[model samples]
Target chain A: MKKTNAGKKYAIFFCQQIDKNQDVNRRSIEKEFGPQIRFFPIPCSGRIEPLHLMRAIESGADKVYVVTCPEGACRYREGNIRARKRLLYTQNLIEEIGLERGMLELIRLKAGNNYTVDKLTRELLG
Target chain B: MAHKYHILTSPTPARFKPITKAGIIAWEEGCLKCARCVKKDCVYKVYEKRSLDSRQMLDSLDTACMDCFRCVQNCPNRLIQKSINPLYKALGDNYWTPEIIENIWNQAENGRVPVSGGGYHGPFSGPGFDAMWTDMSEIVRPTRDGIHGREYISTTVDLGRKLMSLEFDSGGKLISSPPPLVEIPLPVIFDVLPWSPGGKGINLAFLEAARNTRTFAVIHQADFMTDMDEYVPNIILFADDDVLKLSKEMIRRLKIIELPDSGNVMAIQEHLKKINPALVIFIRFRLSRNASVRAAALAKEGAEVIHLTANENGMGKAEDPLFIKDRIRQIHSHLIEAGLRDEVTLIGSGGVAMAEHVAKLVICGADAVAVDIPLLVAMECRVCRRCTEGISCPVDLENIDYAWGASRIRNLISGWHNQLLEVMGAMGIREIRRMRGEMGRAMFFEELEKEIFSGMGIKGLINGK
Candidate 1:
């Protein structure tokens, strides 16, 4: 049985601070999912600019997601909050250009929760 | 030169998906997955093309679904719904409202005046500039179309002092040489932003836009680089250095320069004139309790221009601060009483966040207005002031391509110029110079309410009597 969903491509931009464990079984997920899921770890979600998201979509992303630390928990203080606003602003821009706005999203990781990303990914794929 | 002033514009697409006003929520619980599921029947194919943003963890269904309500009504489980996005509500602050920021963004993207299909739905009166209304000439004379009409309406304005009386030389030739004047096609000038993360790139963009528009941008002398020499003709150096320290060649190359107002400002002006008489000097002063009297004195002393700047909210720095409009009126009236109104030009800055504020400031007494914040808005700034706090700007404005930034600023200015033209055309004024100090053509809420409602029959209604 296949461990990952087929045919759909997903791009993930996660903040490095959220999953500090470095070896969070991402390789197993990637190995199981193969090229269907791509992970781009960023220093902070605040570094996720509007162009980066647009380029991801323009580069053939079926969907793009930004994973960040929970509000008030960002290592850089307001990184998550700023990321949220930028994501929304980017959504509006894409909608104006005839793109579906739901192609982008911002996910906040629960503090001290190690299994949330995996669970969220599984739920999303399902 | 032809009287034509046209702003060339091109469509510049946004690099990111913009925050939309609303988002849709569709619950999947208790789904029967019927033969003809409501999702399959979505007119917009929102469900058929549904995908998840793995990064943001958002469902594409929310963004793609048009608010037709077909799915909401047809869904057997009634799982579909729409709600206003909280992020949309958080775009801007009290003064730089979200709507205004969005409008500026649209204008910058397309260089078109935002046209709402429906009638005006906003309140008739509110605080600040909204409380005043300009009288339109459409009812009396419908033939004149301001912006798109056959007749050319000029927006050109001169920036310099004018001689009160003409003097002749011994040979019967005019010897009272006119002061050097810089004529800009538009009455608006680019003012340095109060706060921005994008240092040189933003300044370059502003300078480029100012040059393209044939206007001036007030740049701090310290920030002026050697590479920016080509734009010197359109650059107004706000000099902090002593007049004697500035090279004669630098003064010669520049068209206009601004100096901070001080007790010895006249002496400094005279010293600058000796270096380059062609340079138009503008004294920059903060709007305060003594601004009116000070302005009158400066004009009497033969100051070429006076730039009166209020706080960010257009309020003075006094205990009981007057608004920019009131301060300008006071200065204008004081100058008029001193018979020096025609000697100097008044350029008002601060709290000029919108195009309408430009016209209102002019009507109150400014010959021109210097705008700062709207330019930042054009580049999609939310006025979050995170940059001021030494934090990274969410927009990454510092890395912005100068071309893109310049184009956005140009488009924003184009929108403003069109609006100014419309106002002038509707007021039966052909030139912006004529629009200045035309207070009679505009009605202030305070004045109108007092005149019409004061001592009226209705008690407690007029200010509760």
Candidate 2:
């Protein structure tokens, strides 16, 4: 739902759920980079299959990352935890298959934390 | 010089109803002397007061069924129409469905094959042999020289394992597994009938015809793999046995041995490797979406001969024939893409109807083909929908002359061969074998209909695409 900017490398920030904040994220991200980070919001990060992430890379994505809630804080409760496992499994598969594993990353943020977003963004962009 | 008319013609093979016309039988016990039965009750008006002869009743049964049931409906004491015909057994059989029987009857009547001048008219495509059609865009161009300059293309094919080369060792005599190949002058080959019309004469006729044409007839392994299998080395007998059991002294005389679908072609290749590795092991696989994959795998596994077939009627799936051909082409292209196209031989069958069909199939990438029902059709058949109704056969197969049938079949194959040449010449290709899978020499009807026809000829097909 949200559009991001091109201040940095092409990266996907997959959100756990799409909401009014998606517009907020799109505006702020675009305001920063115009059209760089492409945010794909799903119903829950748990629904993302590893194959989907692999396919995204195969189709020319430089990097992909999932944004879930901080531990034990997601409204869907166990969904964020599932997303972490899926992400880890996918990263391992890519490593075993001799692809760049660092390209696939996961970052967690509390429900109402702007400071965490900036910090995570700083880490991902770095 | 002349034209033909279509009257009461069917789109598929014409078959006859298994039941012959009804015969009049007199019940001596119930006749009040039946004066009314002779006067107005006979539908065919064949009833007369004369002494009834059982032989005459049988001879006159010729599909003239009144079915009024007048005698049954009007019998004051209920008598007549109770003729017990032994031939009633002719109607029901696995292959000879009531519909198949009717098609045979139509063929029997004219002593000629039934045909539809129009395009196909069935429900959906069928399984196996009924799903494909050969592409024929190059059909009309005449590059061959005949009387003035029309060339004649031959439909003959060889049925033996081909080899890259052979070598010897040990005492330096030779350690070669020279595969036996059969060379037929025509592309048509006799196949095991869909129905087992277990008549020695019919099989003999088929064999005799194939022999005469320098081609081979295929009999199921079930036929001669037993007691009566002493000789007849010219006939290609297909069996499911391991090649080790097939080591007979007359190995050189065998034309071909169609391998059964055992999923393990390696054992077959290994067995043949003992004798002549070139012993053609024709792998018969049915047509399907995965046929290309299957074909590619077979070629990879060292299959000598690969056969892709639909069903008896030329279809084996519920998809379009073009779609099926595409599937086969993909497999062929996959082999080529994988740089293994020359390793195995390809044969396709089913849904190959016209002479143009042969060339088209070759273009789709088959070295040769195996035809089924069209053989019977060319010998005279209509695909009627009746064979199992406890009735009699309208067509008297017992009385057909085999020689006449063979000539008609020969004419048909010969006609097709010339057409193949016609298409090949149009594309400026001299050798047909080289034209296999050459898409550059063809135009899919759909493609042409879409791109070129949007502005050009033919009033009906313009879709403004």
Candidate 3:
């Protein structure tokens, strides 16, 4: 961990149903990634406001990951579609304000049991 | 006891967490794990007390950090860094700059004159009010310090027409009926905001603050609620398109009513005067290329008060717009030339963003100023226009308690009043009336530039333009 950006803070906002895909233990994730890695579970990805995402960065998160359901697979029909539009808007606002690019990411997970929160966190670390 | 006007103020904290100017981006990646870490050396204890407010999604470190930079300097791995907060930078538009918003917020919270530690690092001169400098030539003399002096410096200003001369009968009795006039302790008034979160609470806050300060708040005829009856004395009914909405009782109770300039403006003024001869009516209109001509005509027409307004940026509506300061000067000069300057009151509105702008506008010829956006900013508005776009206000301005909002507004005015006193004292001007259009006590950047540098290029000079 003695390297630049190794201890960077992160926040992951995901749909609550995404946890059903794989057995993701929140305590285990905290034990491995340390307290800097934060989690926020929402009922649906579309419920997230652009203010929430911008506020995450303002709250000292180096990067934010918004995990949404796959296209057309959202239980709320167009929830994932709405989330994508909001994420795009938030990204543009960040860039327009001269903030670092790529600080925000929108991840659309496929409808399968192959994904886990722990695995997703490790993949982002790379 | 002789009535001495003073605004009582107390510290009123912000209803919501403010967007701070700078944020520390400290990454803990390369931890040497020293026996005594740099985070522990923070004298402000900002690092140890670091926590995120989930509701606001704000970092405590950003607001609590004194910016001593000790932690940044002592970090062995060079991990800590300070950068301008993007949210702070995006608070307001180009006209209402982030710095101005921050200053207003600080003043509202503490009701204190803002004093930055560092010397001024801003440009010497820019556009509009920045292009003029108030002469503080008497500053070295201790007696001129009005803020802590025994001498009384009056910021009071009258808000209606004045009689140029009083005629006497042969028996030495007054023969003319004196025109009614209203006076306020300060030269500032609460004007209608261009847009807001839109709630009764917001309007109540403005009215309450106006009542508490013994000043007038401009309320449109449409927004007049029955609950505002108690504040009638402090409310100036802005008669928009329709004057029939006003009842005689309401007119009699009110001290002033503003009428939008129309084709039959004088007839309407006369009609309103018939209802309450003691009432003062102010003629309101937008500033344009013909603003001076229109203002002089209005003065000649016996308009008690002529309120000239510019846009939010102090720019008039024209193909080539002039700033409010220049427009006020033009209208003032025009009225003086026509021998009508002493008859009417000129209340300048728009783009008065700071306390110094208040004094500067008066120096440029305005008798008083009407403020709009800064009052909203006192209520923690970021000028983000979210409320205007039908988006929820980030600060929850719609749900604010009117009493708290009123206190914050009062605090802001108190801060401005104190600063006004300091500026007047420095200029050795005891009364605000004398400060009006006193161009001899001020300096303009354009005139000084032309006087100093205009001759350089004409004569044999090095690379003169």
Which candidate achieves the best TM-score against the true structure?
Answer: 3
Residue B153 error for model 2, in Å? 4.4
**Which scores better on lDDT, 1 or 3?**
3
Off by over 4 Å in 3: A1-126, B32-40, B139-142, B455-465
Order the candidate numbers by DockQ, best to worst: 3, 1, 2
Better model by DockQ: candidate 1 vs candidate 2: 1
Better of 1 and 3 by DockQ: 3
- Cα lDDT, model 3, residue A58: 85
User: Best candidate per lDDT, number?
Assistant: 3
User: Residue B277, candidate 2: how far off, in angstroms?
Assistant: 5.0
Query: B16-132 in candidate 1: lDDT tens per residue?
Result: 434556665334334577724344567788778666554344455656666677776787776555666544565666667767777888888888877776698777787777778
Candidate 2 Cα errors over 4 Å, as ranges: A1-126, B1-143, B146-181, B225-233, B241-247, B250-252, B273-278, B317-324, B385-392, B398-404, B425-428, B452-465
Write down the TM-score for model 3. Answer: 0.79
Question: Positional deviation of B159 in candidate 2, in angstroms?
Answer: 4.7
Candidate 3, overall lDDT? Answer: 0.83
Tens digits of per-residue lDDT for model 2, A1-126:
223523334445444342324423343443454334545444455545566576666655667777776677654456577778777889999899798888898777666655434345545666
Candidate 3 local lDDT, A1-126, one digit each (tens): 335658899888876556653222444565566657777655567656677898889888999998888888876566677778888989999999998668998899877655677776667666
Listed in order, each prediction's TM-score against the native is 0.74, 0.50, 0.79
Question: What are the RMSD figures for all models against the true structure?
Answer: 10.7, 28.4, 12.1
